[model samples]
Target: MNNTYITSFDYQVPIDKIPIAELRQVFIDDFSDHVDDLESPKFQNITLDEIEAVSVYQNYNPGTEVISVIEKVLTDKSDGRELDLIIDYSVVSKLENGLSIGNKIQEQLNARNALVLSVGNGGCLSFMLALKTAQAFMQANDQYKNVLLFSEDHVIGNRYNPGLNVLGDGASAILLQSETDSTMQLVDVECYNMGRLNPVLGVRHDLKGNFKYKEFENKIQPLHYKVIYDLFNKVLRNNSLKIEDIDLVLYQNMSHNDYVGLKSALQLSEDQLHYGKMKGHGHVFGSDIIINMCHSTEQGKLEKAKNIVAISSGAGFSWAVSLIKN
Candidate 1:
């Protein structure tokens, strides 16, 4: 396998920030028809303080959000190497420009030479999916020396995920180099289908072609710790590293309390964890990992981080974990 290094990453969100407090009623209204099930976990004990605010794109064509950040990052692309782009394919912005998700973004970038592709079922695990595929492509295709991996979310209607974190509208662009650099090197990326668990279909279309949300899962399986520990352990074992060998752990901004089981499962110290963009952006799909990574690097925290692991679980009931040596 060819070595892949991440030289830089950038993220963008709409200027508008909607306080979670103000969005409570709208969240409840989204599932009003299903709220009558008093025993359902979706309506249970959801407090406003769990999340502070989530950034959103008012116009709602999330393809623009993905394109904006990539263009901003590529403006300084002086390396002049042929570039290939990989992005989450679920933006649902076809109505905006009548193009496929990947093609719409590629056209917006206007890079005729740049190859573009999409990853399906892109939620919290999309970044890992894209990263793994991008690195593999880099190893096989010599024409491309750098790859841009991006993720953006807005569609699927209501951003709120029931009792989970509010999905924020944002996009992240990560630049990966085929050669080693003084930045982060890809150690390994592992993803599991996890299809047995329930899928988190936020909003769905009805037979009449109208919009409606499926009844939120009466309860989500609480066995994430096992899945996480097993996968992380496998990555660490394959790489000949232990939990104590990792310098930092970045998990998605699912919710404040969601980390309890994760923290316990990983056996990590409080200081070993870095929570970035949680209160500010909430969960921005798999972008949360890249966003948190950029946030940590911007705050000068990466200097203290050597080997880091990012973990996320989402929509397709997928689990993804990546280990990087910085």
Candidate 2:
């Protein structure tokens, strides 16, 4: 009841190939196509597969590439349908000057002059929250038909981050339609803000004059699972379903051990918790959940998913779950 409920949806879920939860994502890293391994050796064991940092982009304009990526997704996946609205979830979207990017996108994409809005919410959870916002907009009003929720992020300063997993950049474009059933439909959603763990934007200059990216994931580590347990239980209860009743559960990619710990804590079967994406992409900040959903569907893991649950937690200190029914 607290989340948006769209009555319609339309889209073909690809049983093969990389495509949404259809999704087209691109990562521009200084490390090239190879998984960029970090130089840090102290916490290597704890970080594990997530040690590879997608890093940053200095050559190409990130904003421009993001727009380009969105254009490609629209060209290939939009199916000639015009957009009703665009919700951008990214770190740069918070900039006062960054607002123009939205306008440029709207004008360039032939989106039919759809409204463009920015959601500066960070972390993977921010992406889900943005998706929920789009779903809610269509639910609350019928004027908006299909919505495009785009997420993009880049670390502005250092190439390697000691905080958590992702110290890189990525962009994802997802199409959410109204009044149809071909793609995943938003059944229910829940979001809770724990508090601000990272600054809204900008990097700090330390005594050495090096740009520093700060993260406070350690502060709430103790209460993390408790919050996840309660948040998920509420969403499941709202849908009148239980963990066993759901076919698949996907969480944002983090460390391999993090996934193992979460699966055990949530009492999820191996099939339910699909965290294999972590090995390949590491943590992609806000785009992790969307990419993971696309990964699961293409791998045919999502084929068995009827009442699938996708959840994520972000440095914005927010947790969110979106229950989708096939």
Candidate 3:
């Protein structure tokens, strides 16, 4: 195993200051004329109460959000630090024009000496992929010092669909270094992608085809649980550990029911899970795990924890689980 650690992380939600209620009000006002459309089952039976509970941001741009997080992380924490590589995980090729967001971030951060790259398109599993890639990079090159992984998503275009889970606009930054002195160590990572299920969710016309949203929704939850259960076992077995060895588990915040379904399927107790605040943060792509980890640390929940597991599933039918030794 190569020496790799998650030294530091920070996240930013530009519209986090706004209350969920206000966000919901805006939606109500915009879609007031189509009450029937909003009431449809396709919208997940969304109500004003549900909107007020789930976190969401209306107009923030993900590209701008990503740049802000990167600037803050480098200024406040990574000052004078040199990065060997920077990876941006996003859904689109470029936020604006033809220039990649990763390249723009690299230039703005004065990381000209570092290699810049981008991967994934609205895939929540991108963060795990980024970490895995960083680990592999460190193992292949002793000179590799630090790798910056940045991810962000904003409510854009049809993403405001009333029938989908509340999507928030935010960005998160994680710094992975070759040093072993950090508090969080990357123990192991496991990822699986089921290409056949790609059309079950997301906006890609080619991937989605003529699939009925209602039919897909009915089967998606069980698939989520099954994949998570299998990945959980695979990660534990690979690390020579068991369920009892995991002190805490974090997952991508989809909705209230999502957390409950996973907990029931996995047979995990409340003490072993951390997802209560998800209703307040909604789903911010792959940043949910990092956000949960940060909150848990702030709340002193990780004080007694030795090992933590972070799991994420993307709309592209990809699932990833990573174990961290604290």
Return whichever of 1 and 3 wins on lDDT. 3
Better of 2 and 3 by lDDT: 3
For lDDT, candidate 1 versus 2, the one ahead is 1
Q: Candidate 2, which segments miss by more than 4 Å at Cα?
A: 1-45, 49-58, 75-81, 92-96, 159-163, 181-183, 196-218
Q: What is candidate 1's CA lDDT for residue 269?
A: 85
Tens digit of per-residue lDDT, candidate 2, span 167-186: 44566777776644355567
In order of appearance, the predictions have TM-scores of 0.86, 0.76, 0.83
Q: List model 3 lDDT by residue over 248-313, tens digit each.
A: 988877666667777887788898888745555666776877788788888887656898988888
**Model with the higher TM-score, candidate 1 or 2:** 1
Which of the numbered candidates is closest to the native, going by highest lDDT?
A: 3
Model 1 clashes, total count: 0
**Residue pairs with backbone atoms closer than 3 Å in model 1 (clashes):** none
Candidate 2: C-alpha lDDT: 0.60
Q: lDDT tens string, model 1, 1-326?
A: 45788877788877899888666667566544543354545346555366788888786764666776776666665232356545553433344564446766666666567677777554567678888888777777776667777766664555555555676777778778775354678878898765544433421212121212233332234556778888999999989998888888889887766776588788888877886667768877767887888778787877688889989876556687889987
